[model samples]
Target chain A: MTGAPLLAVNNIEVIYDHVILVLKGVSLQVPEEGIVALLGANGAGKTTTLKAVSNLLGAERGDVTKGTIEYRGERVEKLSPNELVTRGVVQVMEGRHCFGHLTVEENLMTGAYTRTDGRGAIRDDLDLVYRYFPRLQQRRTSQAGYVSGGEQQMTAIGRALMSKPKMILLDEPSMGLAPQLVEEIFEIVKRLNEEEKVSFLLAEQNTNIALKYARYGYILENGRVVMDGNAAELAANEDVKEFYLGLSGTKRKSYRDVKHYRRRKRWLS
Target chain B: MADLFFFLEVLIGGLLSGVLYSLVALGFVLIYKASGVFNFAQGAMVLLAGLTFVRLTQILGSEHPWDGMFVLALAITFAVMIALAFAVERVVLRPLVNQAQIIMFMATIGLTFFLEGAAQGVWGSQVHRLNLGVSELPIIIGDVLLPPLDLVAAAAAAAMVAGLAVFFSRTRIGRALRAVADDHQAALSVGIPLQSIWVVVWSVAGIVALFAGLVWGAKLGVQFSLTLVALKALPVLILGGFTSIPGAIIGGLIIGASEKLAEVFIGPLVGGAIENWFPYMLALVFLLFRPQGLFGEKIIKRV
Candidate 1:
């Protein structure tokens, strides 16, 4: 919201298989050393926005047909995902995709694949990752497939850290984890932001947690941004409270009452 | 005592032959690991390498008996293998990126035919002698007899396997390859170039095929039928799993030894020639218990 944004996605449209339009005129930005949260329900183009930024759309036969994506003052719409990694923009994909067969350490080393730095620097970075996610260091030699879901998520983030990225596009970090684990992971993300100064544009369905951690938040519905504001403002908004946080400001009511009350909202109608 | 000694000879011989089968199967495993393509052209590639080496050797030998001619012939053969690697990567793999696995597999089958035809067309279908300077005479070791050529092949296969083990585990490219094998998209996300990895992998597989061809052609001859030896590697692959390098080696040894032993012991019960179907039968029976093969990871379907 201040100086030039670190990453700016400008009115991008994505189509899959040359037929189905997935994301329509989606736009958002993350300033340098800032965390932005993309909040949406299922099928709301949250993941698509992340993919569009990282240039991973081509693998799934999806193309960014309209608009542009800029990172660090350079247009990155046409670059390959690996090229983006070289420029220090990395994405942790939706499903916590750890190389299941590789050892946990091997998975982390792969994150450093784009870096030309010497072994000593890479090792120091590995130690830095371990300090953040100590669980990963403990399971460093275990096959990633055998690790627990929380550990796998840590490995994914740790692997991203090995690249020494300037920013990370995190997709659904709290997808299948317990609530406590989710909180723990988000705290580390917060610490990393504050200490390492790595920016994050995380897409999350858990709006309560996402907004709590992110400095700025954007809410998407049906492939378009419906609302956005500062974290505190969005949390205090009435519509977001009822729909996203499931918090009804008024008195408690039965299921039928809630359904009837929801139909009365102007946005839903 | 004499019969016991003969049995020992057969077992040792079978193991050595199994090493040869592993060599060819290694070619399949390398390509399959990198690109997820079941390269049916591996056999034809082997044939092409062998024929090219032998043809070059003959032409150069006829000119002079100089030792440099042999080195030149080998150098030319290596260049041919590298050229084939580039051609396959560019023409077959790059265009077919992100296609269905079955479609890629079928493309490799088409590649098999194309390569087979090209090899025959260019080198002529006549059988050519391949002498890699290894003696064909059987060497007597203690009470058992072994073919010196088989010993050489086993040593070569062992060295190649060791080299590959070091490559996959220690080197950066090797680690990237293992990552590519795990998940192509994840590998791409980490900034590994999928196309270049495919080319490097295809080139390595080509080199493996060339070595396989040299050994097999020396044992038999550089004829069209030499391509059919790749069929032997199929059973090896089925037993070893399509993805495991060690699986290929072990599976090759199992198939090679079992087929030969069956031919020696069980052949008399049947009308003989059980070698033709023994490995397949063994693989089928083995698959009945472990469908993923010896080293292949068990597929866990998550809803």
Candidate 2:
């Protein structure tokens, strides 16, 4: 309750090959115990922002040209992905990224890669992850690739939990899922947040569902934040409504007009 | 009758040689399985181990007799291989872990050149006799004369393969290695130190290489020419899956037997030197039909 932000993503810009400016002046904060959501459309640089923060932006070929990322007030911009994991900054990545040949249990065990706890303690936590995700326990010995999409997503999140991370940067947890599964996944996320007090900064395209779980939210459009506030406030905003909420308003026409206007602005610039 | 006996002799000889080839191939499979890198320098590592054993025996046992010299030489070589494995892991593999597969593969090729030069620099470029003194007398039972050295090579290869199988399937370190081989990122997340696993694998591969060198040296005098024996292993690998130990063994036996048979029965029809190209030709045919090799996992590419 009385400490610096768990993670501070200051005005950072990420460019791919120095030409494809993916993330332009992006910034966000995750309090020690809060669920922060990053909402954006496809290719809105949500994943890029997470990658940049994780110090895993694939070197100069995919560089974060500007801005600073600090975790617990320590600059982690220059650290390797493994170093970031060691510092307890773990990302559950966009896709499941589960080891296809490994069992669900093995996959979960990998999450605790950075941990140096006793085997029994690790086993106890693994049981806890299984308790939270019963389906994984049921299919513990099964190959991860053979699991259903929903189950794979659960395994991914569960794997990250094994690390006992200070904060998790979830990239599109609900991607490529059935609606019911999406709801189930988000419900689990909400439960995890309330029960464990684990911090999360989820990048998601499903605004309606994302807003339901996130206490605070930032809306990204074309690599920049156009709207930011409490989830409910932003959910109610005209711009957020017109663009993401599918609400009919003058903001809808203006949003579409800006796309056309941006081309002209680009030409002039 | 003499012609048939000669045919059988060559067949047995080739099969024995193939067993040795398979042993070397197993080393390749172990490293490749743990890490996706083909470890093109596996051949060089084998030659290096062979040279090291010869040099150690010469330098360490010159005053002493050759009684337990073979075992002592092997022990020294094992230690050297382990150190070499660590060096390669820290210096060559660790930095190139995130690089492209091609780059990693090329780096191993470079490693091959470095090892070859270093081996020659250390052992010099002379053929030395390694009389394993393990009863080279051929056991004659009925009409068959089986060389004890050949029997030792075959048994040793089988025993080593079995031992490796048990190590991988039953041990925690082996399980961790398999996990790293399956998915490096996932393995990292689980807290498996990839560097440690790579070192262990390379060390194990090095041990296997030394064992191969010993058996092979017993049959053919140890020299730079010993490295050329590793070429037969390539065909064995092509026949066996890149990561499959059994594939290497079976592929080796087939290549070894076929080449000898070709030399004995088919050599007269095709002039000579069929032994040189027979394994490769067999491997090329296997490749055309089953590119994944006998034991390799089939990778289906989808658009």
Candidate 3:
């Protein structure tokens, strides 16, 4: 928590369709040049929190009704998603939403739409992205829809990198990828963070992989932060271990059996 | 040999008329690509452009007996189209953002009525000729005949298509437009302003409409019937698919040629005027075989 945080969400509450409260008092921060993970299962408001920061909630009839999201010390609640992007904060949405009709290079070039830089710098950035994800360079001319799932994910991330963004909100990069592909993608993410000094706020369901790469982590449950600690500390915590990591002291019969045994929750107390 | 020459004459005439239909259809494709709205006002925009050009020509020609008046009139007409583009973007499209595609489509239908009424109110309801200095005489090549106006229209359409192709592929704004066409959310996430893209697209559509208006108005005169050209382009759109530009061009050629050929060959069986419904019937049969239309991307559904 030294120096100013790159992005800070203060007790934000999001409501969808003006009635359904999706996120109730969720808060987190990513320091400058740091990688932070927002770990949660489905319906836990992880995506909602990320969307709130990126100002993308308006597209889905959702709004942050309470609290503020400060990026670079400016209140971003009123800013549009494209405005946030121009300010060097961009989000790679879930489901690897690549432009299916465009070629891989065209899709990547779109990320630099707001950039006022010359062609040589943009080309350098493309080469930089290609260096990180060499597989993308080989399939650069192929239509993004025709590429494989892992390559689509790389194209999505590479597209974000082309923007020269200071921070990226990555939502479920490993959602549908195989285990080995997931590891490879996370390894590239780690390399980008270490080499390019880009900050990341990753919303991930893969708690084990996320905690391994993230410097700090926040565990969300039922739209609230249930726990927050350093990555190693959260990895060692007993509750996170039993619920999220799926590891136990002794061999359990099944997840259902563990649920029956932990019917009376410790975290809720 | 005489009958064969007649057949070639009819075929060439049909292809030339197809160029006009493609010009109108290109307006629809531009708006639909940028906003996903099937713009029914395109025909009305064409009518408006023709009316503006005719009225401007008369006004300028009457005031100044110089030849530059026509060029000035053309410039004024372009400015008017740009203003119309801004008006449509601000008044109609801006408020209707993120609405359903059907709702936007309906809005454009409403726009058709308003534009038609406005054009007639401003320029009077009388038919007016648009003379772009092209000779009306036919050129005789051996046994075949070619109308000069039709040749001009085809050349104009080809030039416009080539220019549009370059715009879409080579220019930055054009590339952004293609991205917007592929995916709106992805385009927005990359810092492309959706609103500005819509404005640019509507402006481009307006320009296309103006060119169509000029061509069709020169042949048929600017009248209430010009509004019906939009209805004609719908069948062209159906034959080509709603989303494809090349589809629009090919669809226009198919509809234009088939309808002409059917009118000449099969008109005796159906008692003539088969030109009225032949394109629609042809589109229906084509849709039955390939619902996506020729050159359209095959839709892939994922659960």
Candidate 4:
């Protein structure tokens, strides 16, 4: 919010199979080289929103039915996913779907498919990825499917890096990783953002760590962004802490006294 | 000594014919690996390719065969196959992009019938002779004799496989194709154009079909029955595995040699013409031992 944003999603809605609605006029922004967290529950449409910006909705039978996504002050929601990549935008999808059959190095090489730059640059990028995730270089020749989950995530991110993207839409980087690994990955994400000057719109369910690393956060609930604010402000908010962080100012109440607290949870969802 | 030379002749011929069958199976494997579709249209595509090439050669000139329009016709027919790939990509694959694998499978089955009818509609149903200019008679090698035509066909098939292997290993697009084969969603996220990959794969399959057409058309005559020759590759695919390149070649060799051996040695004991169904019987038995075949990747089952 200090300067013109790099990406702006203006009240976009998504629907699947032309019947079931998903995102309901949701909007968000990422400033140049910003780390913005899209925090939400499982079905809060975090992945949907990331996919919408990457134009990957069509692959999943999902369509952005309303509003627009602008990148670098241009309407880019209409562009194909690969075309978006050529414009230096890439997404690391949830689940870290690496090419299981291919070696990790081959998987990284595939990211440069659209790049017209020579092999020397691609080779340099490969080395750069290895520098960031040194573990990946060790496992580079191993089949991606056979590698550990953390390595797969690193390979996915490293693969995105090979594309030389200006921005990365990362969905659920902490989905199944241990908390220690999550912190390590976020540190790398921070490094990538700062060093590469690549903006990030990261969608996650782990709000505390996400807010710790991100400058701003948007908390989505049931397909709409229910709340958004500066990272510190949102983390401190009582509702956000109580609901998302499993935190509350008050001490734990008696089981008998708060048995109907389920009422509150049900109402919030 | 005579009996051994006769056996060698049968074995060499079987191996050569095996190479040709592998050519057909290669077409199926390429499309299947990229898109997860079985591409039932592959056999029909071979027929279409043969019909188009034979018709083109006829329109141009078949008399000179070497210096004249035969090479020109080959070039033109290849262009036609590429054009057909573009049309199939736009009309068939794009609309059904995210459809289930079975749905794509059904479309290919539909495509099989459509291509057969369309090719026949355009090129006519009459059988045409395809002379590849190679001598059909056997060349005497000391005591053993080899069919010159089979040798030529084997050489051509070998060349195509080598080129394709190089293409897959050394090129960027090849790596992208393998990525698509591994995971479609991830591939798309990495900016691999799935549609463009499909077009390239289908065109490559088309090229495979064209070469198959030239060999089989010369052998069996360019008739609708050329499709049946392609259908014979089904057993080759089953034995080789649907997703492997080397599997297709090895599977084709196994099927070819086994069928010829069965027909020559076992046919007398089991009545006759067992070669027609011998490979199928072998594949049926193969499925019992290993459902994934020799080279197909086994589906990992997590506990």
Q: Backbone clashes per model, in order?
A: 0, 5, 0, 0
Shift of residue B122 alpha carbon in model 2, Å:
2.5
lDDT tens digits, residue span B177-293, model 4? 989998899999999999999999999999999999988999999999988877888999999999999999999999999899889999999798999999999999989998788
Q: Which runs in model 2 stand beyond 4 Å of their true positions?
A: A1-3, A15-21, A58-66, A249-269, B1-15, B62-75, B94-97, B140-143, B166-173, B185-196, B265-272, B300-303
lDDT of 4 by residue, A31-130 (tens): 9999999998889999999999999998988998899999999999889999999999999999999898889999899989888989999999999999
Q: Model 2 TM-score?
A: 0.87
lDDT of each: 0.90, 0.82, 0.89, 0.91
Backbone clash pairs for candidate 4 read none
Residue lDDT tens for model 2, A119-144: 88888889989988999999999988
Q: Would you estimate the TM-scores of all the predictions? A: 0.97, 0.87, 0.97, 0.97
- lDDT tens digits, residue span B128-201, model 2: 78777678678875456778888887987788889988887655677678778877765654456688899999
- Which stretches of model 4 miss by more than 4 angstroms? A250-258, A262-269, B300-303
Fraction of native Cα contacts kept in each candidate? 0.67, 0.29, 0.60, 0.87
* Highest DockQ scorer: 4
Ranking, lDDT, top scorer first:
4, 1, 3, 2
What is residue A215's positional error in candidate 4, in angstroms?
Answer: 0.9
RMSD in Å for candidate 2, one decimal? Answer: 4.0
Candidate 1 per-residue C-alpha lDDT over B38-89 given as tens digits, one digit per residue, 9 for 90 to 100: 8999999999899988889888874433378878987898988888888888
Each model's DockQ score: 0.67, 0.29, 0.66, 0.76
Q: For residues B178-247, what per-residue lDDT tens digits would candidate 3 score against the true structure?
A: 8898888878777788888888888899889989998899899989899899888988888888788899
Tell me which of candidates 2 and 3 scores higher on lDDT: 3
